[model samples]
Target: MRVKVDADKCEGHNRCCALAPELFDVDDYGTATALNDGNVPPELEEKAKLAVQNCPEYAIEFVKD
Candidate 1:
């Protein structure tokens, strides 16, 4: 599965990065950005979902492609 992060909804919380550093990147201001083009590896799928679930803004989502 793939994932995508909503830049508009991100509020620099960094929770996503804290949960899954490999899947996310934190900006200078602490906003989270998905890594690897948000293309989650199978082994890391659960971590990706956890990051999405823990985001306070609910800015992360699975992409259907």
Candidate 2:
């Protein structure tokens, strides 16, 4: 599975980064960004999904391949 973060929708909450720092990172403004070029590691997919679910602004999404 792949993950996508809509920077436009993000409110710099940092929840995604907090949930999976290995998979996500926060930009200078604190918006969540993918650390792996949008590729979600199989082991971290659940955490990534949780990040997506926990995003208050609905900024994260999973794109299944």
Candidate 3:
């Protein structure tokens, strides 16, 4: 599974990082950055999807490969 973040659509929400810190990181300014270039480990795939689902700004997306 792969996760994608639309920085342009992000609203500085840290939910993604909060949900899965290993998979996502929040900058000092509160923007989110993907730690794995969209590649998520199988164990963390669910959390990644949860992060995408919980993003208030609808900035995160998950793609299955």
* Separate clash counts for every candidate: 0, 0, 0
* Candidate with maximal lDDT: 1
Q: Give the TM-score (vs. native) of candidate 1.
A: 0.94
> For candidate 2, what is the TM-score?
0.91
* C-alpha lDDT of all candidate models, in order: 0.90, 0.87, 0.89
Superior candidate under lDDT, 1 versus 2: 1
Model 1 poorest 10 in a row by lDDT: 26-35
Query: Could you report the Cα RMSD, in angstroms, for every candidate shown?
Result: 0.7, 1.0, 1.1
Compute the lDDT of residue 60 as modeled in candidate 1. Answer: 95
List candidate 3 segments past 4 Å from native.
none
Candidate 1 whole-model C-alpha lDDT, 0 to 1: 0.90
Give model 3's clash tally.
Answer: 0
> At residue 35, what lDDT does model 1 achieve?
94
- Write the residue-wise lDDT of candidate 2 on 1-65 in tens digits: 88889989999999988898888888798877887688976898789889989999999998866
Between candidates 1 and 3, the TM-score winner: 1
Question: Which digits, one per residue and each the tens of the lDDT, describe model 1 over residues 9-46?
Answer: 99988988988999999889777788989999899999
**How does model 3 score by TM-score?**
0.91
